[model samples]
Target chain A: MKIEEKDVFKSYFKNLTLRERAVFEGGITLGALFHQFVGTPVSLKNREILERSIEESMKNQPCVEDISVEIVGNLKEDEYVSLEGKMLDVKLKVKVENTVAYLRLRYIKELNYPLMYVERIDEE
Target chain B: MKIEEKDVFKSYFKNLTLRERAVFEGGITLGALFHQFVGTPVSLKNREILERSIEESMKNQPCVEDISVEIVGNLKEDEYVSLEGKMLDVKLKVKVENTVAYLRLRYIKELNYPLMYVERIDEE
Candidate 1:
């Protein structure tokens, strides 16, 4: 993410109510993990390893109540890492403040960007 | 968008504060427009017409405070409409709750879908 992008997110997060902020933090965590895997392999197993690491990492973030990462990529080893062909699917189920944001992302092979789109942002 | 997806978004939108709700309405409008352009031409001028229509349509939405739509696609007329090889960019700037959300989207050529990503959600 660019500096400007981070700044904007920070600004928005600060405006949310404490509970809401906590919920949004889950989205941020998933986004950051996706960022770390820009050139990584796009296989199911590789995604699992990354998911484990991310879940472990989220333990320290107070706002994260729960998180689940599902990576879906079924490509051969060679094509999996190549930037020319293949998109890594990253799905996240995050819960905070009694709210859940179901985010789905396609890790850009060329840009390595992860856009945690809120396919479902819910309050319960 | 799927029926489930729309339901999820509707539930979330109902929970937002009125002002926040207004701002978010902008994203929805842009998303709907992006959906309408699927299988359509990817030319810059074609995008302009669609953008104009979207902006005008948004006026009827009471929650819409202000909105701007920018479409970015520079392909030949023939190559533009073909779904196989192009991404149509739809950028939206929405104002709400005394805040602004900068959303960027790429209309999926195959799926004809729009994922309005909040590149930046800010409070000013």
Candidate 2:
């Protein structure tokens, strides 16, 4: 974002603390990542590009410092399946000023849910 | 969900009140909707089906009672554009037990953001 455009964007989030903002943006990104790609057609042929695409697109969101997305599953080369939440493992970092929130999205076997949660927060 | 499956899911959310659960599910749906389809190829020919497909897919999320998705923009017959956040207008209903949350995902020109928020909460 241009400096002026960023200022305008930051104005809307003035009410939140830096840590809060970081966590909020992380939550939004994690939620967006799961929902948007959960039903996509995926196969061994397209897996790598799909992961890179997801990482690149999510970088456009506010405060995304970095991200890594992996699609984990076994696929037969000839067939494709709709992407499922259980197959995603993501690590996201969101920065708001000095506060950086590390967040994760992965399926937890016990809960049987693709959980999104803040892993840690750091000031840098 | 089958009764047993639903019980397992509910057990994970036992720490949350019905209102919180409803809102959390609503937020996830909204964020997911924006991120998942923003860059999809869309034109007049595929717009209606795309909208229906999005609605159907999101309904699979937990607690989603109903959802309406409208893709608003001008599109030519022969060309397609990557769907943008500005084109989405969504109303989502999430129900947790007797509580219901109405959420919206829409572009607010003043904020220059595709904003997501809880519109209202109802108890039944």
For model 2, residues A1-124, the per-residue Cα lDDT tens digits are 5322466566655554566556656767888888778889999999999999999998987778899999998999799999999999999998877888788888888777777766777888
Give the alpha carbon lDDT tens digit for every residue of B1-124 in model 1: 4221344334434545533443334444543454344455445446667667656765544234455666555556544553221254555565654666555555543434333345666768
Q: Write the per-residue lDDT of candidate 2 for residues B1-124, one digit (tens) a residue.
A: 5322465556655544566567656766788888788899999999999999999998987778999999998898799999999999999998877898787788888777777756677889
| lDDT minimum window of 10 residues, candidate 2 chain B | B1-10
Error of 2 at B56 (Å): 1.0
lDDT of 1 at A11: 46
DockQ scores for all the models shown? 0.03, 0.25
lDDT of each: 0.48, 0.80
How far in Å is the alpha carbon of B64 misplaced in model 2?
Answer: 0.4
Task: Please report, as a residue range, the 10-residue window in candidate 1 chain A with the lowest summed lDDT.
Answer: A1-10
Query: Of the candidates shown, which would achieve the greatest TM-score relative to the real structure?
Result: 2
Q: After superposition, how far is residue A41 of candidate 2 from its true place, in Å?
A: 13
